[model samples]
Structures are given as C-alpha cells and as structure tokens.
Target: MAITMTKGQTGLTGNAAIAVAMKQINPDVCAAYPITPSTTVIEDFSSYVADGKVTTELITVESEHSAMSACIGASAAGARVMTATSAQGLALMWEMLYIASGMRLPIILTNVNRALSAPINIHCDHSDSMGARDSGWIQIYSETVQEGYDNLIQAVRIAEDERVLLPAMVCLDGFITSHAIENIALLEDEDVKKFVGEYRAQNSLLDTDKPSTYGAMTLPDVYINFKHQQSQAIARAKEVVIEVGKEFGKKFGRTYALFDAYRLEDAEAAIVILNSAAGTTKVAVDELRKQGKLVGALRPRLFRPFPFKEIADALSHVKAIAVLDRADSMSGFGGPVFNEVRSALYDADKRPKVMSRIYGLGGRDYKVKDALGVFNELQKVLETGKVETLQKYITI
Candidate 1:
C-alpha cells in the first residue's frame, strides 16, 4: 500500500497529538505516572480531566509498576484501560507487563522510546521496548507525530479484538518525534467513538453474577498449554492489525500495514529500518533514485509478532540489504532487527545478502548524509557480490 497522508491540524507535538487521541477515546480508566518526553501526554490529558471533558477516571500512581498494576485491575473489571511511560519506567513495569498480557487484559499503552540508563541518558533508543520484545505485548513503532496518534487509536481495536486479547504498546521515539511539532489531522470525536465502539470485555471481574478469576497460578502440567494458547492469539493479530488499518482508511483515509515499503519493488539495494528514521532514509532513497541507483527502504511498523514471511517476500528481489537498529544488542553479534530479518530470509527462494548496522544511540543524529552513506555501501555490496563487514556502527 502507498503511504497515505492526511493533513489539517498543524504544529502539534507528538505528545500532544497522542493526548488528543486519548481525550477522544475517553476510555473508562487511565492509570498514569510521569516520565520525561511522555510526561506532557498525561499533563495535557489531566487538564481535560480537570475540565470534565472526558469521563475517564484518572488514577495517579507512585511508579510505573503501580500504574500498570492499576491498568490490569481496571481491565479485569471490564473497564477500557490505558497508560503511558518511557525507558526506566517501562523497565520497572517489566514484571507486571507479563501479568497484563498473560491474562489477556487488552490494555493500551503509549511508550515513548528512550535509552535505558546505566550511563544516565534520557534520549531516544529502542532498548526499552526491545528489552520487552518477548514480554508478549503487541509492539507498533511510529515514524511521526501523525503515526503515533494514528497507531494508538487503532491499537484499541487491535488489542481488544476477541481473537487477539493482548496489551499493545504504541511507541514513538522519545525527545525526537515525542517533542517535535508536526502536521497531523484528527478524526471527528463522534467518528472515533463509533469506530472503537464500546469495549465489552467477555469476562468482567466486576460481574459478581458470573464470577471469574484472574492471574491464577497454574501447575507445570497445564502451564505450557496455556502459553501455547497465548502464543496463538498473538499469531492471529497480524491479520487483525491489517483489517483494522483498512477499516480505518475507509473511514479516516489513512491506512496502515505490517510494514511500509518505499521505492523497494524491483530495487537492487534496500535499507530495512524502524520508526522515525524511515523518514530520513526515504529522503536518501529518493536522492539515490534520482541518480539512477536502484535503492529502496522498508520500515517495519509492527515489531512483535513480526511478519517474517511477508517481509521475506517483499525483499526477495533485492540484491543486498542493510538493516539498521537504534540500539545495540550487546551480544557481540548484531542488533535485534538485523538478526530477525536475516533469519526471516533463511527460507526464501532467493535470499539477498544482508548486513547489520547500529546507529542513533541515546538520540544521536541520523541525517540524510548518514543514510546516503549506508546506501552507498549497499551499492558497493551489489557490485562485488560480497558483504565485507557483517556488522558495524554508523552515524557516530
């Protein structure tokens, strides 16, 4: 699908756009705690709360763990729940994250991507969300303020679907997209209300008439079986995400998919990336195409429950590829996205040569020049039919 654009409202920061989405959603409950880059999301929503603009019951908590805990409880009670956090805040909620997903809470969370601390950085990176990649939450990365807003709105339908009752994290790069003002258009309040509809959880804890239990301990005999079901549910979400995207487009005119591909078809070289960097890389791709180079870009929007086969097919024709990651894997091998993309191509009929590159750690600049350099390297790989270095750092 081509990149869909909707323009109307302008000069809204990513955080503010997300807040507007939340206000329009008017969920039953909101569990909030403050963290940089994402703090204003809550602050702006709180003003709406103060003015009685939304009927949501806002619960102020002490920590991110407590925040997620409250979301689990509210969701179990049949209330549509949501929250927001970043980096270390997400780390603190790690334990609770499992309980939310494992129990099928279908809560919506907006995680502003930030670098995890040891050397104390408060900037953009994928380490926070990457660490929880296996935590069973559906992950969607956004490339701009518009996507961040759009994704969160769609996430409500995706997570709440009966076939895929799992929590979802709509992640936007912290201090980058999160702080940058950009063009965006919001759907009408009534339209958003009609689209999401009213959340009717099948098994509400508050229904004393039909009593139910949550987070009950299971013995090893049946534990693996329960996990298998959870795994299958996430596996089914890939289709639901696409379905919702289409419906959203029919209504709002901006459709999304598993991943967004630009100038990739019939290209000789391509760059595989995620989130906001795709915008910069696309500029590089346009420049190279003008120079008579066959190059392209593919940005994976959905991260968890990765579309391995779909991605493999999309990239089958390329002669060589460069997969860029915002965070280092620290395994002395390559970044997380590189490993997964390489593995995906293992079964392809014509597997292209793929290499890994890490960049933009702690919010380092990834300009068009840096992307041009990567594309230049890909051109060399196409000429020699060899990848000199399997992995390296870029844009330092």
Candidate 2:
C-alpha cells in the first residue's frame, strides 16, 4: 500500500523522536518508569498525555517491573500497550520480560541500550539487550534517531501480526542516539495512523463470547511444545519484519533489512557490527573504497532469530570477516554476536575466516579510525590465509 507523508524536517533527539512516534500511534496504554536516557521517552510521552495531545492512558508506575507487568495485563486485556526502559531498569523487568513474550501479548518496548551494573555505571552498551536476547522477543537495533523512530512505528505492526503475535524490542544506543539531536522528517499523523492501523487481536482476554486462558501451567509433555510454538512465532516474524520494512520504505523512502549490507557484494573482506557504531563504520568503508579496497560492513538490524542463513549467504563470498561486539559474553569462546556469526557460517560451502573484536563497553569512544583498523586486520587475514587470534579487544 502506498502512503503519502507530508515532508517537514525537525531537529530531535532519539528520545524525543520515540515520544513523537508514540504520540502518533497513541497506544491505548503506556506504563513506564524513569531511568537515565530512557526516562525522556516516558517523560515526554507523559507530557503529551497531560496536554490532551493524545488519548492514551498514561500509567505512572513506581518501578520498571510494575511497568512491564501493567503492560502485560493491558495487552492481555486487548489494549495496545507500550513502555520504555534502560540498563538496570530493563534488568529489573527481566522475569516479566519473558512472561510478556511467553503469553504472546504483542507488547512493544523501547529499550535504550545501557551497560548492566557491576560497578553501577550508566553508559551506552549492548549488555542489557543482549542479556535478554533469549527471552523470545523480536529485537531491532537502530543506528540513528531516524531509524529509532522508524523502527518503533514498524515494531507495532511486526508485534501484532496474527501470524507472529510476539513481543518486540526497539533498541537504540543510550545517550549517543538517545540524547543527540539530529534532523529527521516525520510522517503526517493521519498517514501514520492509517499505516499503523487499528489493533485487532485474534483472541483477546476481554472477548466474552469466546473465553480463553493465559499462563496456564503445562505438564512436562506439553511445556516443550509451547516453547517450540513461541519459537515458531519468531521464525514467522522474520518474514513479517521484511514485509513491513518494505512497505514502510515505499511510504517513507527509507528501506530496512534484517541486516544493512554496505558495499558487501564482491568484497573480499568485511566488518560486522550493530547499533550506532555502524554509522562510523560506513565512513571508514567509503574511505577504503577510494583506495580500490574490497572492504565492506554488515550491520544486523534483527538480532533475536539471528537470520542465520541470510547472514551466512551475505558473507559466504568474503575471504575474511571481523565481528565486533559492544558487549562481551565472558563465556571463554567469544562475544555473543561472534558466537552466533561463527555458528551461522559453520556449515557454509565457502565460509570466511572470522575473527571477534570486542569494543565500546561503558560508552567508550569508537572512531572511524578504529573501524578502519578492523578492516585493515581483515585485509591482513585475507592476504595471509591464517587466523592469528580467534577473539581480541579493539582499543580506541
């Protein structure tokens, strides 16, 4: 379907863009608590609710856990629900995070990426979102404020699809993208409302004629099957994500993919990373291309289901590749993204010699030079046909 959006550019931070998206969608309920970086999302959204800008029910919850619990309840009761959190706030809602997805509530959450506490630091990192990677939620990472807003709009459709009624996380780097202002064009409210459409749940808990049960205890025999069903929902969601992305692009002129591939075709070496770092990597890629180098980058937008085959296919032709992780797995093997990328290429017909590089923990600066260094390392690995270290840290 073609959508006509009014063209108007505005400068907004990632948090403000998210709030703008929420105001456009005007979900039935928003249950959220305040946290650094992410706090602005709920704060601005609350102001919209107060000024009569939107008709959403703004639930000022006491804690992140309660916020998620309330979202699950509202979703179960057939209301379109949303919430936002970061770092420890997301960690606190871990248990309920699984419950929301396990119940197939189709709740949408905006997770501002932050480092999980040990030293109690509040900075941008992938630990929080990566930690919840296995919680049955579809994850979409954003590289800029524009993508953050675009992802949030598409997230609603992806989550509420009848074939894939699962929860989704629209994640953006804390402070970096969340607080940094950038120019972005917003779609008309009527067009956004028309594109998002009205939420139509298949089996709502509020339906009186056809009663249903949620969260019922299952025996050992059926538990595995339920888990498999949840797995299948996400598997189906991959296709829905692509379809929604295509429609969104056709309407908004911005195309999205499971992973954004930059100059990857016919490249002999590449670097794989995620989030805002991809923006920096692109600058490096462009510079290297001028020297007739076959260097490229692959930034994964969808992380949960992994898009194993698609990723393997994209990198199958490259001779060497570097996978950069913003957070460490500490599993002695490699970072989370590294492990997954390696596993995806394990059985490829023409697999690339892959290396892992961990960078940007606790908001460390990752510059274009750092990305160029990784590309240079990949070029070296390609020329030597030998892997020096399987995993190492990239110092900026």
Candidate 3:
C-alpha cells in the first residue's frame, strides 16, 4: 500500500465525489434511473459521458429494476459495471439484486439512503438499505462526504476480488451527505486508476473459449448449495474488505475500518449508531466527557457481513449500551441493527445490557441533545441493572 498525494483536492458534494470516483475508476458500463438524492450521481456521471470525459457505456434505464438488470447483463458479459438508486428505486430492484449477487456479478452500486414511502417522503432514512441487508450484497455506510467518496473507490476493489466476487453498495444518508457540500481530498485520476486497477472477468458469459451457464434454475438440493457458496463468499468479504481499506488508506491517506470507535476503551456506557448521526453522537460524547461522564460512541461502517464478534468485543467492557437505528425492523422486538447487536452479544461471558433507540425517520432532525438523551437512558439502565424499555423511539 503506497500513499499518493494528488494536487487536485477540492470541495465537493457527496454526489459529485461519487461521480468523480466513477470517472477515475472508469468502469466499462453504467446503467441507472433517476431518483432523488441518488439521481445526481447518475446525472453527473451521464454529463461526463456526454462530454466524452469517460469511455463508459452509459445506459439510461426506464426503471431501477431495469437499471440493475442492465448492469447484471454487462457485468456477466465481463464488463466492470455500476449503478445508483434510492428509496423505491431500490425497492423496484429487489428481485434483480438477488440475481446480481447470486450470479456472483461484482457490480458496484451507490445507494443514497432515503425513507420508504406510504406517506411518501423524499427524505433520509436507513429503511431502504436495511431492507436489503440480507440480499447477499456487501454494504458499507458513509458518515461524511469524504467517506462516501473514499468508500465508493474502495468498493470496486472489494467487489471485484476473486475471493469475494459479490455485488457491493456504498451508502450515504439521502439529502444529508448526498446533497451537502463539504471539503474532500481527492486522489489524482491516475492514482485512482492505478488503485482500482483494470477489472478482469473470471467466468464471463463472453468467454466463448470456456463457456458457462449462469442464473440457471436449480433443484432444492443444488439451490441450497449455491446459496451456501454465496454465504461463504460474503464471509470471505470481511477479510477482503479490511485488506482493501488498509491498502486504500496507505495509498490515499484516509484510513477506514469495519466501524469507527470513539472514546469507548474505558467508557462505562456507549451508543452504537451509523451514518451522519454518529457525528452528532460524537459531539454529545465530547460534551459528556467534559462533565467527567464515561460516555462513548460506535459507528459501524460495514453492515453486511455484520462484524458480530468484533462488535461484541468492542462493547464487552461497557456496562450499558444503546443501539440507535434510523429504521425500524417492525419485528415487534427491535430495529435490524439492534437485533444483530443483541444476538452478537448473547453468548458473551460479560455482556452489556443493550437497548434499542429508533430515530430520524423521513429525515427528521437529530441533534446533540437527542444523542445525549440516549446516553442518559443508558446511564439509567446501568444504575438500575435493568432495561425498562428494550426498544423506544426518539422524539425531536
């Protein structure tokens, strides 16, 4: 891993950063449909293609499902492929998403996290991506514009790795990170090109010399086995993700981890979260620390391949823990992340009492006070040796 400093660092929105990353990686094909929050990624990248800025074969699909379908075809034909979508756009692609990963296509997707509709909102939430958590795609959440940019570049290498040839998504909070302007250090075009490297297909449909079948209907016996292999590949992706992130850091000077732990080492209580809200929680933690409170925060970057053991270890020392989720699982128990974290610590010898807090649905504002309130609840649980509510929603 060699670090390269580029002279082209500039201020960019997360969507612009995504487009810039795509231009540098220069995938063979990109297929997408227009959807809010994520639409800019497609719009910007399309302009690049229109201006002859990249050699990518851009396809403007009519719907998100078709966009993913086109990407799957291009990827199976041995082309590096990419796409972007949000909210119901992601919902429409649900069926094809399984096909992409089950066929082992290394397609990269930028999913701008947005609220699911019934009341119909075009705001930020984790509902879209969390619904696809079990879809067999590797998922990475971004906390800032810079992380959004860096993660997209790293996702290419991770998805295309021979040992982990599965589709991956780099997710950013919908209007928050995606549309917000922020300063970011960019890698020179040549550096990103060198970093991502040229993609080579191993079992491509185009390889007439060694022809193969894909997505073939299988009997129960064979279907289960194929699913087993997909499981193994995602399991292997955990290591590949770490290796790629480390290499990316060495080359680009921005280190990434499965999750970012803040002031957790000696803390007695902590809040676990993801995406932009983690930054607010950090501020709350800092304020609490000033008052000599042992408060900490954990923000998970990797959601799929859900680093269970590592998370359990990270929280093992705390007496009480609260997992804050932007989406509800509606399972009558807790949110998706809360369930996973609780399950992860079930077998630990000295497990902390964990509670779940759901907040910010449909782009509701979450401030430092909201985070501090969660911390205060955790402190109460610590003092009482019991959790009054296993799951609760944050108001305002």
Candidate 4:
C-alpha cells in the first residue's frame, strides 16, 4: 500500500504535534509521567483515550522511572509501547533506558529538551538529551514542529526494522520549539497507517507457544558478544534512517535526510548544528551568502548514528567549519558535535579545519548575529589559525 498526502493543516505546538502523531500510530500501551514541556504530549494522549478516540492502555505513573518500567513490561508482553519525558524525568529513567534497548523493545519516545538542574531551570536546552547520549537507543533531533511530527512516525519504522529492533527517541527543544506554536502540515491517518503499518514482533518474550527468556544476566565471556551484537544493530540503523526518511518523504512530500544541507554545495564555510539553533544559523548563512561570503549551514537530523559519512562529504569542499553545540562536556576537550565532526574528517585526504563554539546553554538566547560571529571567527581560523574559546553558560 502507498501512502498519500493531504492538504489539511493545523496550527499546533511541537508537543501537540507529537501527541497527534502518537494517536495516529495507535500504540497498544502508553506509559508516561507528567513533566514540563513534555507533559502536554501525554496529557493530549490521555484525553484521546478518555474521549474514545483511541483504545489503548494509558498508564500514568507517579515517576518517570516507573513510567519507563511499565513500558518495558507492556512491550515485553508483545504490545507496541510509547512514552515522553524531559530533564529530571529523563534522568530518572536512565536505568530502564538501557534495559528497554538491551531487551530490543521497539518503544518510541520523545524527549523535550530542557536544562538539567543544579539550581533547577525549566527552559529550552540540550542538557537533557545530551545526558542520555550513551543510552542504547536511536536518537534524532528535530529543528521544527513539523519535523518532530514527521520524525516520530519514521522513528517507529527505523526502530522496528528486522535488522534493527531497538528503541528510538525523537528530541525537540523544550520551550523554544516544543511549546512554540507553528503551522504544521500533518500526514493523514491513512497515509501514516500505510507508512508505518502494524507492529510485528519477531522474537517477543510474551509469545506463549514460543516462550523465551529475556533480560537475562550473562557472564563476562558472553556479555562481550551481546554488546558487539547491540553495536552492530545500531551501526545498521544509519541506513535504515535514511531509507525510512526517503519513504516518509515519498509518502508525505516532506524530505529529511540524516543531515540536511542548506546552500553547502560550493560554499567556502559552513556552521554545523543540531535542533532549533539550526534555524538561526540558516538565517546567518543566508545573510552571509548575500554579502558575497560563501557560507552555508549543515543541520544534523539524526544524532545517535552521528551521520559521519554524510557530514564529511558535505564539508569536504569547505575551507573551515564551526560546530555550534548547545551543551558542554565540562571534562571533554570539546562539545559533542565538535568531537564528532573532528573525528569524521580526521582521516580525510582534504578536510575543513573545524572549530567548536559552545553557545545557548541553560536556555540562553542565541541570535543570528551570534551565528554570524562564529562564522567570522571560522573565517579567521581558516586565514590565521587562531580563535578564542567562549566560556560555558555565556550566550556570546
């Protein structure tokens, strides 16, 4: 069956877009806890369940940890499961986050990006999502409300693929994008149903006739092999993300590769970013290019697999690249994107000299001018090989 697009449109927040997508997917079970920025998604889902729009088990747990635990059980029972959370809530679910993927459950989740607390701030940032970067799940960041809605649908297909049966997380900036209202063109129910069909469990523990043990604790000798298998599955998901994205575009007329390039074809410099900041960087890129400066922007749509090959190829012709990271590593030598970009181009015969600029931490505002400043600094780095490091928690 082929999915077809419709012209229906709605003014919706990123949170609401996610809820709408989840309702369309029609999961068998939804277990979630209420957390700021992400609360509206589950709230909308609960309303759907109450109004008879969706017939599913909606479990509202007292804490985020319990929410994920319940989802694991529901998924192990051969049911499609889903949930949403942010910041502290995500930190609470850390242990189960590992278990959900290790068990190979095709659970889909959304992490509305928010700042992690030392003093407790509740606004848009990447701290929450960055904290869970090492968890065994496919992670994709959306720069706009429409992308968030579309990615949630594609994430299921990527996670449930036979070759890559792991959980996936669709992340959006907490208040900046998640709460901001936008005109979003959503896929019709028929199109979504055709694109992401019924959930088929290949080796679920809940199968009665073919009973199998799950979450088994293994000895050291066998544990290495399990880790190796998990790594291979994640590595294979890179191709699945690209394929599913293409299929989604073919069905809905909206295309998003693992990394989207804006005017980067023959540009001399480019800014690499993820999430909502990409929107601002694009503006800077446009202005710079208009002034006879050959600048462009590279926005990473998928973060977990890192999209190293595409990133390297995209920046191969550029002279210098500036990686804007919203979160900091503290102990690491550079930001997450900076680390990945450097690693991706280190062995190339000809590659751009990259600089890491930390910005927009703790929900600080990042304007287009800030992006331009980074681009200017990148030009300076290319010309003279000298650039200053911006301290943490400062906007500019």
Candidate 5:
C-alpha cells in the first residue's frame, strides 16, 4: 500500500510527534509502561488505541521490565512490536534488551533520553541510552522534534530489515525535545503505512509447521557463535540503515545519513557532538565562520554501529577537534561519545588533535555561547599545536 503526506506543517513536541508516528505505522502491538518525559509518548499512543485510530494492541504492563518482556513475546509471535521509556525505565529493561536482540526480534523502542539515578534526575542526558550501547540494539539518535518523528519511522524499517533483525532504540533528549514543540511535517497515514510497509517476520515461534525454541541457553563456544552472528548482523545493519534512509528520503522530503555534518568540509577545526546540542554547536560553527574561522561541527545520527571510518574521514582534514558529550562516561579519561569519536580517528591519514568536553548532564543548558567557548578552545589547540587539557568539564 503506497502512502502520501500532508501539504502543511504543524507544531509538535518530540513525544507527540513520535506518538503520532506510532499511530501512523499502527503496529500490531505496543507494550508500554509510563515514565517521566517519555510518559506522554505512551499516553498519546494509548489514546489513539482507545479512539480506534490504529489497530495496535496496547499492552499496559506492570513495570518497565515487563513492558520489554511483553514486547519480546509479541515480537516472537510475529507481531510488529514497539514501546517507549526513559532513564530508570530504560535501565529496567536492560535484561530483556539483550534477550530481545539475542532472539533477533525487531522491536522498535523510542527512548526519551534521561539521566540515570543517584541524587535522582528526571531531565535529559545520553547516559541512559549510552549505558545500553552494547546491549545489541540498533541505536538511532534524534537531534530535534522533526528528526525524532522521522527517525522513529525510519527505525522501524531499519530494525525489521531482514539483514538487521535486531531491536532498535530511537533516542531523543528527554524533556528538552520531549516537551518542546516545533513545526514539523506530518505524513499522510496511508503514505507512512506505505513507507513502513507490512511486517514480514522470517522466523516465528508461532509457526506450528516449523517449531523452534527461543531463549535457550547455549554452551560455551555455542554462545560465542551466537554472538558472532549478532556481530555480523549489527555490522550489516549499518548498510541497511543507509539504504532505508535513502529510500525514506526518496518518499519523503527529508534525507538522513549516518551523521549530520555542518560546514565540516575543508574545516581546520571542528566539534563532534550528538542529539539536540549539535544544533547549538552548528550555531557556534556559523558564528566562527563569519569571523573567517575555518570551523565546523559534526553530529552523529547513528551511535550504535558508531560509523567509525566515515566519522574519522569527515574530521581528518581538521587540525583540531573537540568532542562534546552530554553524559560523562566517568572512565576518568573522557565522555562516552568523546572516547568513541577519538578512537574512530586513530587510523586516520592525518589524525586531528582530539579532546573531550563533558557538559549538560541532567538537562543542563548547552547554549550557543557554551559551544563558542569550546570552539574558542579548539582554535587555541589549532594555533598552539597542543591540547592544553585533553579532557575536561565544560559547564561544571
């Protein structure tokens, strides 16, 4: 069934946009438990279910773990499944996350990113999703309300693609994008249905003719073999993500890539960042450009597969690079994004002097001025040919 889009745009919060996208895709099942910031996503989608806007089976479960557990069960039964959560809720699903991916279930989860507890924070941060980076889920991060809407729809196709029959997490900063509204285009439901197409499960626990056992314990080497297969599938997912992104672009007006680059070509210095803060960094890039500074910014849209080579090549031309992370990895060296981005550039033909700056935990504001300060430091690194401080906190 081919789909179409509306001619105009409307303002929508990140949570609402995603809820609307879920309504359009109209999955067979949605197993959800409410949590802050992300609560609205499930709330709105449930309202759609109540109003008969979609044919989805809304399974309201007891806890976050049960929510993912139900999703795993529904997906194994060959139903297209989806869910939403944030912070502690995401942490609660940690155990089932591995189960879902290991079982090769393509469940799509929209994670409104929030800080993990201890002193307790209900605000935005990448820590929650970042902590699950190796949970074997395809992670696609959104930088805006519009991107949140687009990414969730694209994530469904990416996760369910045969080559990448892996669970996927579509992440957006909590409260920030989750509550903030922005003008975005809404696709005609029929058109989105056409784009996402129908769910085609290759293996089903419910297929009586060919019975199978799921979640069975594997022996020593057998477990490694399973992991090897999972590794290959995630590697294959990078290509699937690119292909689906192009196809989504072809049908819709917006195009997506592994990452979004802002004025990085021929740049002498750059900032590597993610999510909503990337927008701020881009403003800093523009301000620096007007002053005849050769600066740019790179924001990763896909963090799971890490896009190592592509990311490295994009920043290799720069003489100095500053990587920003919203959550500190607490590894003593740098933040998670900084570590990954720095590691990616190791084999570059001309590796730039890379440094890490951790900022904006607990929904702290990362204004353009903060970005400008980071760039100003990068400029010093460019001129001095030395990193005064390889890693440091920016707004602390």
Candidate 6:
C-alpha cells in the first residue's frame, strides 16, 4: 500500500529528504566522500546504515575520486551503487566520472551545487556540474526539496532503462535548498521499489559464464565508436526521462515535464531559469501577470540532453526571453542556460529574441522582485528593439 499522510505533516530538510529517498531505493553499495552542504546527505545515510535499517555496504572514502572509483567497482560487480559530492570534490572525480558513464554503470549521484574555489568558497553555483556537463551524464536540476527527492528517485529508472544505460546526476542548490527545511511528502519504500523495480545489469563485468573486459584501454578506431555509442545512449535517455516522470506521477500525485511553463499560455515575454530560482520566478511571474503584463517563467527540470525541442516549442509564442543563469560562463559567450536557450531556438521558425542575465553568484539571495525586474527588462526588449548583454544584481 502507498504511504498516506495528513495534509499538515511536519517538514524535513532537503538533504534529509534526499537521504530518505535514497534509503527507499536500497542501494547495494554507497561510497561517499564529504563536502560542505552535501556532507549531511551522506551523514544521514550513514546513520541509517548504523541503525541496521539499511543493509548496504557503506564505504567511507578519503576523497571523491575514490568514492566514484568504489562505485564503479561495486557496479561492475552487479550491485546498484550510489554516491554524493559537490564543487571541487566533483572536479576531483572528473576522470572517473567519464569512466563510470562510458562503462555504462547506473550510478546515481546528487550534486549540491557549490561555487568552485579560487580562494576556496562553499556556496551555491553551477561551475562544478557545468564542468562535467559533457562527461556523458544525465543532469536534472531541482527547484524544491520535493522535486529534489522526486528527481533522485526517477534518476535510477532513467539511468537503468536498457535503451539508455547511463549514469545520472540530480542537482540541487547548496545551502540554499540542500540545508533548508521544507515539508516534503516522501514515497513509501514499497512504492519506490515498485517504481524502480529490480536492478538487472546487462553486460556486467562480473558475469561468470560470459566474462568481458571492463574499461580496457582502446585505440582511436574503437574509442571513437565507443564515444559515439555513449552519445546515442544519452540521446535515447531523453525519452526515458519523460516516460519515467509520467510513471512517477501516476504512482504519486506530482508531475513535472522537461520544461514547465507558468502563465506562458499567452504571454509576450518570459524568463527562463533553473533550480530553486524557478520558484522565486514563479511568484514574480504571477505578480507581473496580475498587473496586466503578459509575462511568464520557464523552468527546465532536465538540464542534460537539454530538452532543447521542448524549450524551443514552449517559448515559440513569446516575443522575447530573458535567460537567467545562476553561474556565469566567464571565459565563453554567456552563462550555461543562456547558451543553451540560444542553441535551442537557433533553428526555430518563429524564435523569440533572447537575452542573458547573470545573477546569484557565490550563493547570493535571488528575491522575487529580482525576477519581476527581469520581466520588466524583457518587456522593454520586446517593445523596443534594445536589450542589455548582461545585467547583474538589478536593484528592484
């Protein structure tokens, strides 16, 4: 039977809720390395293991590289594996990250977004995950504690789907959402088990009868094809994401698409954002709409394989789009989301004029009024043929 709760149940922190969801999945092996904001998740899981509530081999690794390496080995041995990390720790595991995805290990990870170090800071930023964006992992950004828990549960299904055997990373803002307490309706263990089903590894290196080499060094001839195959798998995983999300909604009550639109049905302008910023933008969008402004917000839940078509389709009706990026692309053209939105609409017949805005760097608070300000700027761009390149911290 599904777990039932009263309407006014107490709340749980985002990291704690994520730990609850991870326990529901019942991973066979969990190798974790500690990092700020993300450390609490592993800490909670460790306590669960200590209480004998979970029967998984929990390894405490000294570094993130070893954490990912341990997951690869456990997964190769035909066990469902899990781990968590953030920022510089994510950077440290970069090489193994590619290997895990290339070997097609269904390792589910959570990245609490943190600013990568210069003088060493541990605040919310996308630099860490963005650095690994091309490492062949399915990336999903969460806007709320509930969504964070939900995405982590669905990630296993999407990654393990036979047609799309690739790893997935569920990202939530560090400190901002990870450490914030919020009421979240968690799924029952049986429901989660039914949702994820059993882990059946295909081409597992541990198969005794048909043993095969795992991660063997390949020459140019074979390496290229291997990468091509990985790309194809990621491409196919996009469909699996939609399917799993639909199934999750049917089992539970909440549902989210790759890109969710708020008041965009008939709007002249909209601001596209990801992660927790979407929640703030929704409030601003509603306020703007009430004042006779046709403004809306687009939140992309799935960031990898990017939901390009869905985003393009959703923004087709709007005259102009303001892409709000949490992390700036300092060396390149603009922020990650800005580049993605531009790429998605490049081929659209009725593409809307898009502008980029960088905000919330180093874990700065993004207020609802900030979103309203973005909408106002978008209105100006739509009415007149003028737009700013990059607007940072607009005083509203």
Instruction: Write model 2 residue lDDT over 1-396, tens digit each, in one string.
Output: 754444588889999999999999999999999998799999999999999999999898899999999999899989999999999999999999999999998899999999998978788999999999999999999999999999999999999999999999999999999999888888899989998999977677888898999779999989999889999999999999999999999998998889999999989988899999999999999999999999899999999778999999999999999999999998987789999998999989987899999999989999999999988888879879988888998865
TM-score of 3: 0.97
- Which residue pairs show collisions in model 6? none
What is candidate 1's lDDT per residue for 126-175, written digit by digit as tens?
99999999999999999999999999999999999999999999999998
User: With candidate 2 superimposed using the best TM-score fit, by how many Å does residue 306's alpha carbon deviate from the native?
Assistant: 1.2
Q: Give the Cα lDDT of each candidate.
A: 0.94, 0.93, 0.93, 0.88, 0.92, 0.88
Candidate 3 residues lying further than 4 Å off, grouped into runs, are 1-8
Looking at model 6, residue 17 earns an lDDT score of 84
Q: Which stretches of candidate 4 lie over 4 Å from their true place?
A: 1-7, 388-396
Question: For each predicted model, how many residue pairs clash, with residues at least 3 apart or on different chains?
Answer: 0, 0, 0, 0, 2, 0
Clashing pairs in 4: none
lDDT tens per residue, model 4, 1-396: 753444577888999999999999989999999999899999998999999888789998989999999999999888888999999999999999999988888899999999899869888888888888889899999999999999999999999999999999999999899899888898788888788898978776778899988888899989889888988999899999999988877878997798989999988888898999999999998898889888899988998877788788888888888888888877556688788888999867786777777888778999998988888887887677655553233365
Q: What is the Cα-based lDDT of residue 259 in candidate 3?
A: 93
TM-score of candidate 4 against the unseen true structure: 0.95
TM-score of each: 0.97, 0.96, 0.97, 0.95, 0.97, 0.96
lDDT of 6 by residue, 190-303 (tens): 999899899988766778899888989999879999889998999988899898889888879887678788899998999998899889999998888778998888988888
**Listing every candidate in turn, what is its Cα RMSD in Å to the true structure after a full C-alpha superposition?**
3.1, 3.7, 3.5, 3.9, 3.6, 3.1
Winner on lDDT (5 vs 6): 5
